[model samples]
Target: MNIHIIWDEANLPIIKSNLSNVIDVIDDTIAVSFDTWLFSSNGEFVIEFYHDGQTIIGLK
Candidate 1:
């Protein structure tokens, strides 16, 4: 499946400069919730969705 990433203008530049070639740019709603599962080297935690340029450093 193709993952669509919605980002704000401020973060767009950086994302574009960096991850644009990797991920697809999405302009629609980014859905997340307390039920959302996130895992990293640090640990696991619940997460929510935001569109203002947050760095995603873990599980896709």
Candidate 2:
């Protein structure tokens, strides 16, 4: 299982310490939007955070 995390640079330490299953950690510097519907029916585990807004997605 590979986990893709979209987050800010400031949270790097937190991500490194807490998440051991993360495969890719993408900084949110790029101008992109993630539509919930796009991942809603994928049957994968998706976590959306409001504060700091870190998106964690699991892909097979």
Candidate 3:
């Protein structure tokens, strides 16, 4: 099974720091990240169902 994630705005500094490391490596003008602040849902917690259902927000 798979689940989607949302990045909590509360964690952006950590995200920027991590991205900066990647930018230093790739040496580019624009910075981007393909990282996630894990869900702790790795077969450990039961996922909830919402009335709207099934959106793939892809921090995959």
Candidate 4:
């Protein structure tokens, strides 16, 4: 699945370097072909969640 990440352009490079193993980075956000997962570091285990048809999944 193709994944498009949303982040500040300034942080793009750093985020890309870390997530390269899992996703394909693109310059803009558009309709992606596959499921999208967002990962964010929160001073603990990184959180991962998928976007369902309505809202974000895996919220705790």
Q: What is the C-alpha lDDT of each candidate?
A: 0.31, 0.36, 0.32, 0.36
Using TM-score as the measure, the top candidate is: 4
TM-score of each: 0.19, 0.26, 0.18, 0.27
Candidate 2, position 32, lDDT:
37
What does candidate 2's lDDT look like per residue over 1-60, in tens digits? 333444444433222222332323333322233322112233365555434455444553
What is the clash count for each candidate, in the order shown?
Answer: 0, 0, 0, 0
Q: Please say which candidate is ahead in lDDT: 3 or 4.
A: 4
TM-score of 2: 0.26
By TM-score, the candidates rank as: 4, 2, 1, 3
* RMSD of model 4 against the true structure: 10.9
- Residue 29 CA displacement from its true place in model 2, Å: 15
Give the Cα-based TM-score of candidate 1 against the true structure. Answer: 0.19
lDDT of 4: 0.36
lDDT, candidate 4, 1-60, per-residue tens: 222344333434333234454535431221342333344443222323333433353433
Candidate 3 has its poorest 10 consecutive residues by lDDT at 27-36
